[model samples]
Target: MRRVLHVTDCYSTGVGRAVDTIVGLSPEHEHHLLWAGEDDPAGKGFASTTALPGSSLARLRAVRAAVRATGADIVHAHSSRAGVYARAVPAGAPVVYQPHAYKLLDPRLPRAARTAVAAVERALGGRTDRVVVLSEQEARLAARLSPGAGRTVLPNVPSLASPGVRAPQPDGPRRRRVVMSGRVSPQKDPGWLAETAERLRERDPAVEVRWLGSADDPELTARLERAGVSVSGWLPADALVAELTAAGVYLHSAAYEGFPISVLDAAWCDAPVLAREIPAFAGTGLLTVADPAAAADRVLEVLAGGAVRERALQGARDLLREMNPQVQRQRLAEIYA
Candidate 1:
């Protein structure tokens, strides 16, 4: 079995879920994780996991040291921060950098900050043997970074050993709640979700909107809570799946993404998705609109139950047919080969 070393500086949300999908898809390969984050190591089936150092220079050194210690054949780094560490290392293993979402694409970052990040990414781009991306939009961004490295798009699909996605129960009662998953952060755009929630509440105070993850920003959580959106802080897989499967609709409000795993989770659980019109959702066939007001209106129309809701549900299921995990595995085999 090929010994693959997985490195990530982010373990809380998107990057964490992306890694889960990758490692779970190829269990035949031995996987080792080296992470530097507040959360304890949570590997799906890692042979081992090591903690990276606290400082930036130390973390870079630790990445080099871990490569030697593990004798890894391939180094897969998730997120831009870990990409820096992995690409900068002199280790001889092939390096694949997967930016869950480019920091340059984040709407909240300052212009100067983005420019600096872009410069750093371009500097290290040649060191990456292959840059794995999730969508065409992200692929274009990676190409702009540097022309030297090869680019591949591996769409995020639900991994194995997950809570079985309940088949779409057309005759059964669907829960009234509209839900979203992923940590509350600027990228997830809790502010916009809060605005949408308020609009939802104004129309129908009884509307139940729920968030299914922990808070990265307490202030954002407060905004959501004040808007009458209930936050279910970090449910386990089964419970989270149960929530998604029963919800009236899944809402994806992320301002930027490389195809969030949470959206795939909703699709897997047969929850109709009403998502923002970001490039990530571009050709995915989810019921999408350009603005929060339109999204809020769409959610209400969907909840009322009719052709609109039925079409959304059907579209979500059709999308799922294309996102089959086994097919994803076949493609992944090509990447790892």
Candidate 2:
């Protein structure tokens, strides 16, 4: 069996789930994970190490050492940071790099920083055997960043193993709640969430909103709380799933994304999803809104119970089927090959 080393600096987000799925499903190949971060759920089995730190130089050195120690035949680097580090190291192993999302596309960054990151990505493209992206938008961005780089589109699939119990639609009067999961950072547009919650509460004081993730910014956390939105800071998977299942609707307001796993989870849980009209979510069949007000309206429509709600739920199911794990497994095997 070919020994494949998976290297990543981020092991807490959707990227972590992708890594876990790859290693868990592909038993034909020996997998080793060299990762950085505490509480990395993906580093549970097989040969693994957390020697790499987040710093560029440190991660490069650590990855090189891991490659030498493991004698890895193929090296798969995940996330932009790890992708840069792993590609920088000329370890003679075939390298596959997957940038969960391009750093250059982040609008929060300064123009100069974005340009510099793009230049770095272009320079490193030659070192990568293949560049894997999760969406068509990302594939297009990758091509622009590196003109002739070998590329593959491997869409993310929801993990079926931890499918949460679907909460039955309420037959009687019940508390209405809208839920969202992910880190409360600029990327997620916490400001928009806070504003949306305030608008939603104004329309219906009884309506409640909850964010099931850790707060990266204290100011944003306070804003959300002040807006009458409950922020559950990073619950365990089971607990988060339970919270999601109980919710009447799922809302997503990310400024950007490679592909959101939480949206997939919400769809699998049968919660009607109303997400922002972002390129990443285009053609996913989920109902998309332009702004927070539109999102709130969509959620209210789902809660009201009618043909709209039924259609939304059906759309969620269709998306879940489209993102089947078996199809992902086959595509992954080809990429690995």
Candidate 3:
């Protein structure tokens, strides 16, 4: 069997979904997942599973044990910390580092901390066989980080439950709803989103901003509630898809990102987008704004539901067709093989 060990800090719902797609496509490969913080939600679907604690010393021991136990032919890691440990794994084994996004990308991180992480990657990244980034901008950043590190871009793409059928749209009164999905933290900028939603409601009281995310901040839920924005804990996979399809507008206020999966999810659901001006969100015809007032204006324009909304929705669907996950998975298989 072709043995592969995949490592990640948390096997996120998205990461879980991606690994499921890979395994479903290639059954010939033996895949074992190791992660920090939590058990593998994705591994339940797999034929074999292993969960290990992710502490530095524990990781070293567990990885050494997993390497021996699984005889991992390829060690593929899915986050920054995992990448660091994967690189630290003994040489001669093929090591693949997929840092969904580098730690340095978060604007809230102290400059010294970001610099420290960057320096670490620069030093140890050369040891890895390859690095996979999720977007063109990220690819450029990774190239700059380690000159000799082999790298490739595997843009974020969504896979429908089935290959041939278009995803079903959920039936609902549009209600001028605007949705955002991600971890409710500073990186996602939920505070600004709450502020923007209040402004949007002032322009159109019918407008509702619903954030589907894990509330990382206890106070975030309180603040958003004060602004009349609906907050949901992580939804089940099917419910998430339904929620995305039902919304009229999708909002993204992230401070920084690699290639956001939430934006791609909204596109798949055919939700028109209004995003903060970010390089990764380019080409989608999204109303990109620099400030909260401008973002609210863009939201109001789309909620008006005339030529602008139709044009943006059609444009988003066109982009989604091109970025379907089958196209990306094919590219990923080729890169990894």
Candidate 4:
């Protein structure tokens, strides 16, 4: 059996979920996780190592020691920060680096800072055995940023109790509620969501916009509330699933994304999805809206009851088929082999 060591600094977001999925789905392989934070999401079955918050050099030393102690055959790193540390260390194992989303793509960063990050990534490319991305657009971006890097696509799959199970829709009038799930950050474009919520509220007084996750920005959360958006701060998994199941539509207005797991969850839950026209979702067959206003209009249309909602639900089913976990498992095995 191949021993794999998965390294990650952030264990609470999409990166964490991806790592969890990989370990959980691939039971044939021996997986050891090296998490930098105290929150141990790797529950029961696997061996784990934790590192206290420290300088990069200190963390690198800890990771290197972990690699040797575990005698891992392959070292897989998740997210940007962990990628930096994992690629920098001479771990004596093949390194697989998956940057859930490249930091250089963050619009909040200044141009020069983005360029510098690109340079660092390019320099680190030689150390990476495989650069796994969530989508084709991400692969192309990685190629441009880090020329000569070996890149591959391994889409993130949702973790559902029953992989293909569909939620039953109520027969009566649908709730005039729209939901968005994810951490409220600049990438999610909370400002646009706030604007859209106000417009949607004006268009239909009964329309309620609910955000299922918490925001790092208190001011942005307050702004969304003022604009008549219900901010449900970070619901537990079962609760979040319940919210999505009850909602009429799922609206995603991210400025950019690698592959949003929440979108995948919505698709699995059979929620009608209306997302921004971003490259990351280029061929996912998801309905795309140009702006928040357009998204709001789409939500209104769905709430009004028509073929649009049916079409969107069909599209979501198609998306779920493409992201099938069994298919993903085969692809992952090929890569690891």
Please give the clash total of every predicted structure, in order.
Answer: 0, 0, 0, 0
- Distance from true position, residue 153, model 2, in Å? 1.4
> Predictions ranked by TM-score, top down?
1, 4, 2, 3
User: Which model is ahead, 2 or 4, in terms of TM-score?
Assistant: 4
Kindly list the per-residue Cα lDDT of model 4 for residues 1-337, writing each as its tens digit: 7889888888775677777788777888888888764246645357765653578887787778878889899989888888888888686788888999887666678888988898889888878888889888889887876666678788788654333434444445446898988888888888888888988888888888989887768887888889888889867666777788888998897888898888988887778888888888787788888887788888888877779888778877888777878877887887688
lDDT of 1 at 117: 92
> Can you give the lDDT of residue 41 in candidate 1?
56
TM-score of 4: 0.93
Residue 188 of candidate 4: its Cα lDDT? Answer: 86
Score candidate 2 by lDDT: 0.79
Ranking by lDDT: 1, 4, 2, 3
Candidate No. with top lDDT:
1
Which wins on lDDT, candidate 1 or candidate 4? 1
Clash tally for model 1: 0
Q: For candidate 3, which ten residues in a row score worst on lDDT?
A: 36-45
Off by over 4 Å in 1: 38-43, 159-172
Q: Provide the TM-score for each candidate, comma-separated.
A: 0.93, 0.92, 0.91, 0.93
Model 3 / residue 160 / CA error / Å:
4.8
lDDT of 2 at 30: 80
- Quantify all predictions' global Cα lDDT against the true fold: 0.82, 0.79, 0.74, 0.80
